[model samples]
Target: MQLRFLLCLCIVGALAQSDYDEDDGAEGKKDPKEIQDPRGHRPVSRGRETYSAGPAAPPPISGGSRYRGRPTAAPVGKLVLEKEEQPDSGGCNHMSEKMGVLCPTGCDLKKTVQKQERNVRPTVDQLKRSVDELTQSTNSVYGYVLDMTTEVAQRQRVSEGNGLLVGQYTDSLETQHAYIKDAVDITFPQNIKILQAVLDKIREKIQRLEKAISAQRAKCQVPCKVSCPIPVVSGKECEEIIRKGGEESQMYLIRPDPLGMPYKVFCDQTSKNGGWVLIQNRMDGSVDFGRRWDDYRRGFGNIAFDVGKGHCQTPGEYWLGNDRTSQLTKMGPSELLVEMEDWSGSKVYAQYEQFTVQGEATNYILAVGRYSGTAGNTFLNGATELFGENRTMTIHNGMMFSTYDRDNDKWIPGDPSKQCSKEDGGGWWYNRCHSCNPNGRYYWGGSYTKYMAKHGTDDGIVWMNWKGSWYSLKSISMKIRPFFKQK
Candidate 1:
């Protein structure tokens, strides 16, 4: 029995040594060359068998230690071995205190996971904010596009309405134009025909009235058988004749220069027979001697001719001499009258009348008749006649006023003591038989007097002399008829 107890004791000792060996091998000091991880842990070497700190391992019950302390739970989803406890190295222990964990390696994992969560939260917030901003921008753009579309639609509707209104107005205008055009086309010709017919009847009535006036004028002319023996007919009888006969009975007879060329006279019965109907009150200051001659010869002043400057001192319808007293005188028993004036302030009046002897009209004679006025010592001293070319004559009582006896160019008074002498008998008026003093000499030589005797008289102007000087007449008046030849 004692021998069996000894063997049993030996077996027990052997088991205790085996346990101590296992513990020492696992939890003993490590080699100096083995570096620790920054997490305060060393990995098991690949050559050694390591125990996994898995969930399958349970904590030891209270007894001689299978583990020195309670086993820490393994980190989730990681395969890790429980590290053996060593003496407190200041580096890993200090790191563990800062990390707030016993195992620095595991503590590092927790801190890394926390840091990732911290980083991810801000990223998530940034992403959320960006999404909101994008949503808001998209909404704004959509609203703008919608507003623009609405406005465009409204404008398009208004444009369509305006187009329709314009088309309606155009159609209305076209209808009105067509109606007016058709009305005008239908009535214009009928109105024209009615106006033409009325005009034709009015013209026929005018022609008949003109014929009746002609017959009355012819009857009135027959009563005035003898020529009117007056320079101008005034009074009630002349008014009655003019009223009864009217303008139709009035006629103008013109005699142009160089007697009986072609008729140079034109008559405008509508406008005072041109110049034939001379009214003293109608005279304006402006005058042309050549035009007056043209009007006297042609009854109109349309013909142009140059009247030399010295022929007229001033332009007027008539030229009255410087002296005031002058009168128209009837030269014979004929319708014609001659203008007589004594420019020496002698008032001499001559009378004349017209008559048909034996029913034959004598050649119109213009002769000196009688002198009445203040007669000076110079008897019939100076006389001048201003008549147009056609009305003037060179022959007076069959004696030429222009001719002079060439033997006596100068005049001498008839009585030496009486402003007259026989030596003054050189002039035509003194040599030719006349009522004046036979011994007195007369002076006459001028454009009208000298040239008319040779050229047969034209441009009626006469300058007569008595004693020895030249002078002008005061006034002249005459009536003339203006006529144009029948075409």
Candidate 2:
């Protein structure tokens, strides 16, 4: 009943404080204790875990312990708080114990204080999420604001122009906003002290809000300085950029010298969902394996690359592999191919795609990748060359035009016997074997052949070879041979 009354008293008193503070608004709020809950029904608990005293620590080895051996003793000490009694100054801390009145900090306190802050605190995971988001937001905000400031600063400082005005009059407002943002949360306290701090900071700026706004308008009106036109990549004006020119999605442009790219990853604020990603020449962060990411491309006739610390600093050079299993189990192993998709000027395009390896015999593969980009003449930058003992046609996309295996130094001719027609039959097999085909000339991966057997080839390359080594180009000039695996 007493606890209930206390809660009522607190509520009523809080309402009273609220009544008079109407004018104060967000900033001018009264201390909580000033308010009273007439009903006295306040939220109260016996205490935290330790407070209720359910399970006590096994009695310490003290004299009180009923041990037959040596005795144990606990040192008794007293803590004294010296008080210089003074008249109560209408403060919340002021309370009369004799009058049965009580006052405690508006803390979310439980009986047992040692129950861990977690009981009344956010979990580590929650804190981490909040921190990550806040950090991202903070970085994002500063990125834009700093960019604006830098642009203005770079414009040859206008002696008697915009620079001088921006550097002076409106600086305080910006500074105040910065101060509010920089203010961090203090130790958890009953009163929302941090919130109050933010409010105070806002006030500092609100006081001069009009002056700052006017100044902002005046300075920004004439514009600051303009920088010289400079090319960012390849020393050319990037005025026109192909969406897929450099790279797209999760890329890093880290080159050598000072540094290839800026950040390790493409943290472009403009790319929220996903965007173009360019791997630069030089980078710092390394990709770890075994204990890190599991690789699904090991074995199954798939060629493996070096496993180590790697980053996509430069586009041309990249090292990606899995340390686990190294290859698949049941089905045959896959063939790994790092194909150079495009090369515009100094920039290169590369994506990880797989190819199916055929028989043990070394057979040269003549394939052309599709490039319908008619923006200009299509030129073959060449292919990623792989050399070893056995040479076989592993990568089997639907055979398109033709490919000349440089390693084999031979031009593979397509079969011209089996009634060659899109309606008749054509796929990875058709592309190379439209007519009476030779054995071992073109071998399809089990997966693709089986798929094609099921899917019809009348429309597109045999359904199985739809996504195979088949590609059409305006023209095919030179042939490049890829890495040849040992039999």
Candidate 3:
């Protein structure tokens, strides 16, 4: 109980001391804005200079003046202090007087705590801004990666479509190839059979032609190309029969070459050493001579009657075709004899030692050389003989044969153009009309002066040198024979 009374008295004394300390703190305090550091410096945040703790205080020593320990480093942030007046001495006078303890000078615990709190608020705000920047950068990277993934997927789909199209084209090509192979298999054998049948027909025709040729060869002991009027005999020409001891003036078969035709001709075996083949003969003009080019080329008249030692005995007229005549004349060195008779029964002849008629290509051009006989070279010099003109083209020699249809003559272009063949009404070698037209129209009386004068044309059998262009001939004959007899 007595100990408890003493503790109560101690509590009352401590309460009385705390009251006195509060009263003393109130008297020393100044305004918050007028606060200063222990070194009599104000805080920088309050429009005052910063308090620089220059050097650290030394440690305490025995029997020394009081010392205060302070760090040299400045505070972290803005400091706030109240203003205060400095003591005249440098000891811890204000701290000693207020706290009733020995204290270090230049130390302010209240200001240090406030500076740390100020530094912490700004550090927290900077940390928050750094976190916001990091979040924005993460969003940008995610968007780029999403765009790349979408593009790669679209390309994969396009590649699949291309692969499908390629597969379809390959299938179509294989189908076409199969169809073509099937068609070839179906038609190849049929084509071969058709070609074989055609070849068989050709072989049969060739065999039949061979048999017919063999029969023809058998009928003619010698070579014979054309059909003969009479029986086939072994004679090549009239001269050949005469050489083989044949002395007849009759229709006989003659073939010039072994491969040539066996045509019939009047063999005059009794005149001028015999063997004269008559090519043309005209007496009463029984056959028409004024025919077209084809008719003259193939010959038109028949002369199968017998001539016993005389020409035009049976009153027949004929012209051996130009092709046959050319063949016969070109067999060897042949000669031509033209016999003409007038109404007064006077006979005149023209003969050429070298005479040849060319083929149809040159319009059967005539070539005559070395004339001799009663007729005055009228065939070679027709212009001089008939019209007294020195026109060389009017001559018959070296002149192409012309017809009513084929005008190959040298006629001046004028009224009644191509008048030589048309005016003469027959085929002959005509230039400005001829001096001698042996193939002219026949007149019964042999004189047509009135008709010629009225018509202004001489279209009669006119041999101008023999009688004149005014009179037609009564009878005429043309024949050919070799210059030398064949043995």
lDDT of 3 by residue, 353-382 (tens): 888999999999999988989977877777
Q: Model 1: runs farther than 4 Å from truth?
A: 1-140, 198-487
Which tens-of-lDDT digit does each residue in 152-209 have in candidate 1? 9999999999999999999999998898787688767777888899999989988888
lDDT of 1: 0.34
Off by over 4 Å in 2: 1-366, 374-407, 411-487
Clashes of 3: 9
RMSD of each: 33.4, 45.0, 27.2
- TM-score winner between candidates 1 and 3: 3
lDDT of each: 0.34, 0.30, 0.72
Supply candidate 2's per-residue lDDT for 476: 11
Global fold similarity of model 3 (TM-score): 0.49
Ranking by lDDT: 3, 1, 2
**TM of each candidate vs. truth:** 0.21, 0.14, 0.49
Candidate topping lDDT: 3
